[model samples]
Target chain A: MTIDFKQDILAPVATDFATMDTFINEGITSKVALVMAVSKHVVEAGGKRMRPIMCLLAAKACGTEDLEKHRKLAAIIEMLHTATLVHDDVVDESGLRRGRPTANATWNNQTAVLVGDFLISRAFDLLVDLENMVLLKDFSTGTCEIAEGEVLQLQSQHQPDTTEATYLDIIHGKTSRLFELATEGSAILSGKDQYREPLKRYAGHFGNAFQIIDDILDYTSDAETLGKNIGDDLMEGKPTLPLISALQNTVGDDHDLIRKSIATGGTSDLDKIIQIVQNSGALDYCRKRATEETHTAIQALHELPNSQYRLALEKLALLALNRIQ
Target chain B: MTIDFKQDILAPVATDFATMDTFINEGITSKVALVMAVSKHVVEAGGKRMRPIMCLLAAKACGTEDLEKHRKLAAIIEMLHTATLVHDDVVDESGLRRGRPTANATWNNQTAVLVGDFLISRAFDLLVDLENMVLLKDFSTGTCEIAEGEVLQLQSQHQPDTTEATYLDIIHGKTSRLFELATEGSAILSGKDQYREPLKRYAGHFGNAFQIIDDILDYTSDAETLGKNIGDDLMEGKPTLPLISALQNTVGDDHDLIRKSIATGGTSDLDKIIQIVQNSGALDYCRKRATEETHTAIQALHELPNSQYRLALEKLALLALNRIQ
Candidate 1:
């Protein structure tokens, strides 16, 4: 796994993504200063830029030399994704994200929620500027699906008897759909129909792996790395895949405690629940499944011609899977 | 004021509007249903559907034979407006709306916020399917503008020293933009470009009058008629036009108390403050201005051909001005 991680691949793509940054920040121009300050506060806090990078990589791997459209789409994908996070943090009542106080915690819930809306709408404005009706529809549809998925998760919280099929559906809607659209959208824009399905397959597989690893990180990472306390999910009563699977296998007090923890939500002994999850081996089981998905993701990339960009994408998938392991 | 409020005019329009409810209500499509139920709960609570009706009435008045696009756009406008209300209630943290629990109150703040996102996105989904790129762009732009307006309002809330100019700007953003767009958009879709400017003028004037009358209603209406309690705005520390104007004209503790009340929010003496606003003649003053705007709005309708639809449009504006008197 000692593949060269090209700093350049992301740096240039990152610069191009700044147009989205500028557009979102510029949305406040009519008011002067406020929009810029709030938007900059959130955007400056860095992320992996994974979704945008996926768009760039897919566009490159599909052998489309023109990166301009891919660049904007990448930025739109990232902004749309960021908008969701801002709103999600408010919904989760999370105080911290990416090592900083959330917008809701810092300013107020109203500001955070409104800023999130601004970003989401700004994404659509940018998408429309591309003058591609189909892409616009896909991005809009993807956002609606993501919101529905997040709501589903919120509604299903603390319901101990949740099914595996329900969990999978949530994951697909919340995470995979956007990934599928990001890659598939780039391919479509580039007129690379031959690779669109495979690229979508690749993106979906990668997204599932990424989300599983995200859940895994919740269990394994400390406050410094994960930017919040570990077991925060359990405290919030979210029945993430690993937690749900572990609950099914636990016996007696362990099971009851976990269920009670979820039911009471924020009143639970999170430490005890975390230990039960670790002991149940469910975390390892989920990681193994995620690794299998990573393989499937990489396999989809075989449809693309061999290139440095494609390899970078493949390595990124492996990197996600490795994080879980 | 005693002019007949007919079944066809008020009740049937209300019933028809309610009947055309095409939100994501629950059924076989359970996921869409959940999203819709949360949204419809907020919309169906008998709050005024003024903006959508304006869209419907404007199209018919414009001499356009096609009512289908008008109906769809009317629904979309209502959906958009409802989505904003859901988010606004969360932002305001109010418990009751339309004399019942708000979406955030019934289902936690997160689901309410997410449901807003779903409805707004669904509006675009409807617009995109119309096969008109320009209309899609218009709707999307209006959505972002609405978000921007909400953000601006959030930044300005509870600040009593806000000038009349800023007050007008906030109202224009928070209310008039939707009105302007609803009518202007209908005009665009109905191929009535000659009427776009005049219809926009009509919508803006009508919206201003509509909102001012709404502010007056806070003082004049009871909890039962207005749904939610009266002076909820004052309680929330929002300085609507009437209060803003009153604050400027009054002196000493009258000014000081208004400022303090706004700064502290309506935590105490809200009833006394309502009395203060009424005694200061702010409501009557606002009503006079609203009547002036009503006349201007009626004048804006001169561009439309003579018809019953045009008369209805004129009467709606007059109704708004008279509602609070």
Candidate 2:
């Protein structure tokens, strides 16, 4: 069955999500005009508000009805997510994100970098207001890991020999880690220690599935499917999972081409590589792995009591997997 | 009498400074190899460890003898300083800082940006261990202003109309705020509520003097006074104090040239611009302003009891002023 995003996933927390949106606006208000302009541009260009919605849903799923603080946490999570994306655009040297001009492209890389720094500092500033030491500890250490993960990805760039293990580490840092923060952070704020692990586990696997699907889409997706062109990862020499799986499942000329593309990044072999990836059974292996991760992610949600919010979260996982299907 | 850096400024906290250096090394420890390598390169390329030493001295000034915790706080301050410097090099596109290759030059912009982020996160991670809500709030808020200050500076770039008031606001954010954090952070950590304002006042004025002196040196001092060459700020179209003062004191062809050079950033008019800036009475005005700021900085220290540490703080301000003597 096909799932509608607004109906199945965001609908449960739609009102709270609206409130959280205001907090994001309030949060980025700075005395500096350029800081606000770039922040507004990037935050408005956000896609789906997935992390914040997940945060709000998790709070409701934990048997908490009032979401006053949870809404703020959700906004903080999105701000942190936006900060990373701003920096990532600079790192990748991209001109556009989700069909809009990126902060780096809108302003210069220097402006983008500094504004990104402002967003991060502001996110932490709002977080300190929560006044919870435990939450602070989680985010502080979590951010360190998240940064390490990004550097790890950069280190893995242009290297075809990057293993699936390394790819998982990269995705965990650059992607799943934040989702874990989103859900687990909500659990922390709600005073539900019992749900923290379950929420973290669920979000972790969900993030892994989400990122793997994104990597898979990089090979097979059209502009409409992903809002990015195919061969972007290859153009940058990024050794994402699809390429790693392609390396594992193929041999002979197919293998050499994949390795060469990763070693010398560009889309010179774009058509050929896409063709080979489709036929060589690598895409199938990636699909199977993504499915396993999705199953694991959904399985962890059993630890939480049944509720519409829980059902919505489970549906959210399935909807992500549905993209690949 | 000349103030000796090792003897007059850092001597009171020299032992604590040594111990604090280890915390910087320990704090940067990461599972990611590149994070460690880049972090070490930038941190090791530090200059005199000024901010951290001031933090230690401030703690001592607050009558805290056992400086185990204060030592860690000092390290955190240095890490934050190093993080800003790393990003600054990227913003300025500088290949060398203090006669050494910068992180961006040694690696790449992407590596420098990401590693700088790691250092910031790691710095805050270490700060969380201090377990002081007030300290956390000050740092979180201070870092936001720091980033804003940086953005404000960027906005003012290449604009000849930038006012002296805007210039002060820029310097306060970019330089003085962190110094305030360094000294006042020590006060907060030491539980010296009485000394917080005084220490903050001292550092604020000291930072103003320090940056104003540095700006003056950009036009008047040779390469030896500062590691960079003369006309560096002009080449970048930075409306620093020297340029702003020169604009205020000149008219006709001299005024038009200064305005044009600022509007179109290049050192083509380097010799003439320097000639006019020197004869413009701008350097004298800047020096007088620097001295006034240094005096106010030293004056703020009287709030604390007279001790060797307080004397060290006073001498530190004088030594900074002595550079342009």
Candidate 3:
């Protein structure tokens, strides 16, 4: 069955979501006018607030009543997400995000970079206020891994020899780790130690599936539908799953073409690459892998007592998978 | 009395300084090859290690014999400083810092931005290991302010209406705040609550004096002496104290020229603006202000008992002031 996001997923925690949204606005307030302005611009440009919703869902899934702290944690998660996106846009030289002008485009790279730093520091500042040492340690170490993941992605750029294992490491760092933080952190804050591993596993696999679907879209989705063009990843020589899988399945000319495309990034061979990516069964293999990850993620959810929040999270994972279908 | 940096300033904590330097190398260890390579390059390129030295001296001044924790704190301070410098190079688009290639130059902006982020997270990760909540709060809050200060400086860039008070706020955030962190963090780590405020004040004022002297040298010092070109700040339309003071001391043609130079950044008017800035008595005014700030920084040191460490701290402040003389 098709799922409506607001009704099926966000509806259960809609009030907490609203509170968290407001808190994000309140949290980003800075004495510096430029910081406040740039931060407001980027945070407002956020998409769906998926990570925070996951945090709230995990909190409720743990059967916790008092969500005052979770709401703040959700806002902090979004802030960290927004901060990373700001830097990512600067790194990617992206002009627009979700149809809005990016922080770098709105002001300049300097403003974007510094404001991103402000958001990170502010996020940590608020985290310190949570007064939970365990949460602090998790976040501190998680952010480091997240950064290492990003640098690794950069290091892998234009290299065609990157492996599936390396690709998993990349997605885990760049995509899934923050998701784990959102859910596991909720478990930590809720004082539910037992739920931590399951939630982390659920988020990790879900994050991996989510990123795989995104990389899949980069080779398939139209700009109007996805807000980013097809071949965008290939254009940067980013050896995402599709390109990596395509290399593995093809041989002779097809293999050489994929390697050349990754080595010399551009969309000049876009149509040809897309046709090969599909014809060679890379997309099917990618879809199967994503489905398997989604299944594993859903399976991990069974560790928690069955509830509406858990079902909503399960539905959230399914909704992500449905995008490929 | 000529203050020999080695004998007068670093002499008291020379052994500790050497240990702290080793800690920085050890502290920057990363699993990622690129993170390690870039981090090592920047940390090794660091000059004088002023902030960490201040941290070591402050710990000694507090009569803490076990310099173990203090050494780690000192290393953390340098890491934080290095992180900012990495980002600052990206913001300023600087190629070389202290006559060595910047991270941004050695790698790329994307690498620099990400590695800079890794450094920040690593610093906090190590900080969490310190197990001092007070120290953590100070650093988290201080980093936010530092970022805001950077944004504030960017906001004021080329505006020409930036006041001395606003300028002080900028320097306090961008420059002095870290210095404050280095010294105050020492007090926090040493379990010496009484020394925290005094150390923060001393460092704050000393930072102001040092930056002011640096700004003055922007119009005075040659490339060989300062390792930077003259009028570099004016080239960026930075309305530092010299230009602010120049505006105060001139009118009509001179005032208009300085204002235009600030509003429209470039080195085309370099000689003309330099001549106007010097002849307008702005340099003398800036010198007086730097001297006043140095005196206040020294006065704050009186709160600590007289010891070789305190004397070294005093000498450090004086040595910074002597740069202008």
Candidate 4:
């Protein structure tokens, strides 16, 4: 059965999603025109607002009816996500995101960097208004880990010897940590302490699965499929799961080629590398890992009682996995 | 009367200053190797750490000798300041800061941008530990203004139409907002609500004076004294107070040259512009403005009780003014 994203995933919390979108617009209010313009560009360019949707779902999954505060929290999560993406564009020196010109590309790098800073500070400013010390601490610590994860990704770049453990560490920080914040943060704000651990586990595994699938797409999916060019990761010599697993499964020439490609960071041998990555069963290994992660994530959601919001979250994980299948 | 920095400004809080120093080192703890290295490089490259020092002095001026939490706040302020500097170096593309190789120059722009992000997140993480909602609100708002200020400075760059009012707004956001956070945050933490307005006034005026002096020195200061080359701002086409005042005082060719130089940033006409700025009496006008700002900042300290710390805060403002005198 095909699970529709709008019907299966976003449907349960559709009203909350609208509230979240409004909060996102209001949250980015700034006196500076450039800050507002660039923020609107990046925020409007957001894809499906998945993170915020997840946050809304989590709040409802906690069995809370009033989502006034959860809506704001969701908006803050999106702003934080947008902040990372803006800076990520600058760091990657990429001109496009989601097939649109990025903040750094539209404006200069200086504007992008500073505007990104504005979004972060503004997000935190709005967060302080929530007046939840526990929530504040969670977000503060979560954001720090997210940044460290990003730096670690940079540190791993152009190194083919990066281990799977290290790759998980990187993805956990860069991707899953924010997801944990969204889900677990909803639990915290709802005063559902018992739900926090299970929600965190669900989000963590889901984040890992989501990122692993993304890395796989970098090698497997086309620009039309994912809004990103294939071999983009290899262009930067990022030793994502495909390359790392490809190394594990291969011997001799293929292994040496993977090492050289990561160390040198170019797509000159892209065709040959993709062939090796495919023929060596690295794609199969990555898919298996992703599926296991998705399963673990769904299992964690079982700790929560039966509800459509929780089921939507389960379907969201399935939708991500469907990309691979 | 000489107002030696070590003797007059920092001496009053020397013991507390040491405590704050230790907190700064401890605040940056991270498991990521790259984050640690880049953070250490920038934090160690910190200048006299005047923002954090002001925080300490402000705390003591409030008559609170138990400085355990205040030291943490001071460290948080310095980290925030360092985070901005790291991003500023990226924005300006500076190869060196404080006579040391910048993170961008040493590692790369990607490293610099991501590590700068790590610093910001870590700073907020440490801030959450302070556990004061009022202080958090002030910092959160102050940081947004700081980022807005930096963007305004960029927005005003090369326009040659920037007004003194707009310039003040930019400097207050970029410079004084943090200073206000440092001092007013001290008052908030010290539970001295009455001191908040006065401390913010002191910092706001002091920041304006400090930045004006720095902008003036851009044309007047030598590399040995300031570790920055003169004409750097002109090369970037920044419409600083020196140029703004020069525009107010001149007409015809001299006026046209300054306008053209600001609109088209380059040091090709540096010598002529410098001569024009000096002969235009712009320097004297800027000196008057700086002196006025400094006087206002010092006067704000009169609200707090007599203490060596208050005296030190006053001396620090006077010492900044002395840069011109």
Q: List candidate 4 segments past 4 Å from native.
A: A221-224, B221-224
Candidate number that wins on TM-score, 1 or 3: 3
As a whole number from 0 to 100, the lDDT of residue A22 in candidate 2 is 89
lDDT of 1 by residue, B1-325 (tens): 4444443234424544454454323210236456767866876764556777777777777877756667677777887888888999899887887678899999889989899888778777777766677777777777777777777777777888877677666777788889998889888889888988898999888877887777777766452354556777777777787778778678888878888887777647677777778788887788887888889888999988987767777777776665666
Scanning candidate 4 chain B in windows of ten residues, the lowest lDDT window is: B220-229
* TM-score of candidate 1 chain A against the true chain A: 0.91
How good is model 2 by TM-score? Answer: 0.99
Model 1, span A9-121: residue lDDT tens: 56435555566455444443435245556667776664777787888888888888878878778877877788888888898888888888888888888988888887777
Model 4 whole-model lDDT (C-alpha atoms): 0.93
- TM-score of each candidate's B chain against the true B chain: 0.89, 0.98, 0.98, 0.98
List ranges where model 1 is wrong by over 4 Å.
A3-33, A221-224, A266-272, B1-19, B22-33, B46-48, B221-225, B270-281
Query: What interface RMSD do all candidates show, one decimal each?
Result: 1.6, 0.5, 0.5, 0.6
Across B1-325, the per-residue lDDT of candidate 2 in tens digits comes to 6888998888778888998998888888988889989999999999999999999999999999899999999999999999999999999999999899999999999999999888888889999999999999999999999999999999999999999999999999999999999999999999999999999999999999999998988887553563678889999999998889999999999999999999999999999999999999999999999999999999999999999999999999999888888
What digit string (tens of lDDT, one per residue) describes model 3 on residues B1-325? 6999999989889998998898999998767899999999999999999999999999999989999999999999999999999999999999989888899998999999999999999999999999899999999999999999999999999999999999999999999999999999999999999999999999999999999998998998452443477888988999999999999999999999999999999989889988999899999999999999999999999999999999999999898888878
For candidate 1, the docking band is medium
Q: TM-score for chain A of every candidate model?
A: 0.91, 0.98, 0.99, 0.98
Candidate 3 per-residue lDDT over residues A1-325, each given as its tens digit: 7999999999999999998999999998788989988989989988999999999999999999989999999999999999999999999999988888899998999999999999999999999999899999999999999999999999999999999999999999999999999999999999999999999999999999999999998988542444577887998999999989999999999899999999999999999999999988999999999999999999999999999999999999999999889
**Is 3 or 4 the stronger prediction by lDDT?**
3
What 10-residue stretch in candidate 1 chain B is worst by lDDT?
A: B21-30
